[model samples]
Target: MTDLSNAIWRKSSLSGSGNDCVEVADDLPDAVAVRDSEDIQGPALTFESRQWSAFVSGVKRGEFDLA
Candidate 1:
């Protein structure tokens, strides 16, 4: 598992009132660490920077509808 002791996590701005969202850390130079906001001390999934960018772009494009 990656040592995320210094990773800075941020949740989605549109996250609901409840604690239901994914947290991400961009402090890593070549990867992004993601975890459930409801599980702070839980394990996180790491992805390559390029892959993360693509995922964000897809989100902005509404490829994954929230409604």
Candidate 2:
């Protein structure tokens, strides 16, 4: 399991506008952690390094729309 005790999570700056933005923690040795910014005590999702890379690429390519 990922050790999130020291993980640093950050949400989008626009989250102040009341959007339910998700927060992500980088710097994990082999994976990335994601969770709902609005629910800090909620369950988190972990993704392998490679999978995270692909997901990010897809986001940049507009395959997913944040809006």
Candidate 3:
């Protein structure tokens, strides 16, 4: 497991004023960390930089859009 003790997390810009959005940390080397904004010390999902980029692209393209 990567040591994320110094990770800098940021909430998505698309998020509303509420704190119901997820947080992402890209300060890690070669990997991106994603976790719930409400659970800062909770479990996090880590993905490769490229994988995270693809996911973000998909989101921007509405690939996971709900009806």
Candidate 4:
């Protein structure tokens, strides 16, 4: 498991003060971490940097959007 003790988590500006969004921390070397904003003490999912980049790209392309 990746050590994210020092991870700086941030939610999207679009979240607009809601506690229902996911938070992301991309400052870790070679890794990115995501966790539920409403559950900061819960487990976080970590991803390889490249993998996270690809996922972000897919999001930008609406690959995961509901039809």
Candidate 5:
């Protein structure tokens, strides 16, 4: 398991004042962490830097958008 003790999490500013979005921690050297904003202490999902980058690119390209 990756040690995310020092990870710095942040969510998109466009999320508004609601706690319904996910938080991302990309400050880790080897991995990026993601977790529920409403559950900071809950388990997080980690991805390799390259993987995270690809995922982010896909999001920007609307690859996961619902019709």
Candidate 6:
């Protein structure tokens, strides 16, 4: 298991007032941690840095866009 004791999580600045966003912690050595803003103590998903970058790129390109 990854040691998240020192993780610093941050939410998107574009998010609205509703707690309907996710927070990310990229301070880990080799992985990025993501957790729901509504559930701080909930389960977190860990992804490789490269994988996260690719995912972000896809998001920027609207590859996951839905009508």
Candidate 3: Cα lDDT at 64: 100
lDDT score of residue 60 within candidate 5 = 97
lDDT tens per residue, model 6, 3-67 = 88889999898997878999999999999999999999899999999999999999999999998
Q: Per-residue lDDT for 1-67 in model 5, tens only?
A: 8998989999999999999999999999989999999999999999999999999899999999999
User: Where does candidate 1 stray beyond 4 Å?
Assistant: none
> What does each candidate score in C-alpha RMSD?
2.1, 2.4, 1.3, 0.7, 0.8, 1.0
- lDDT, model 3, position 10: 95
Candidate with the greatest lDDT versus the true structure? 4
Q: Pull out the clashing pairs in model 2.
A: none
Q: For residues 1-67, write the lDDT of model 2, one tens digit per residue.
A: 9998888898878778774899999888888999987789989999998999999999999999867
Candidate 1, residues 8-65, lDDT tens digits: the string is: 9998788968788989998898999999989998889999889999999999999999
Q: Estimate each model's TM-score.
A: 0.81, 0.82, 0.87, 0.95, 0.93, 0.91
Candidate 3's displacement at residue 49, Å, is 0.4
Ranking by lDDT: 4, 5, 6, 3, 1, 2
In angstroms, give how far residue 33 of model 5 lies from its true place. 0.3
TM-score for predicted model 4 compared with the true structure: 0.95
Model 5 segments beyond 4 Å from truth? none
Candidate 3, residues 1-67: lDDT per residue as tens digits?
Answer: 9788999999968898878989999989999999999889999999999999999999999999999
Q: Whose lDDT is higher: candidate 1's or candidate 4's?
A: 4
Q: Model-by-model lDDT, in order? A: 0.91, 0.89, 0.93, 0.96, 0.95, 0.94
Off by over 4 Å in 4: none
| Candidate 3 residue spans exceeding 4 A from truth | none
Task: Specify the poorest-scoring 10-residue window by lDDT in model 5.
Answer: 1-10
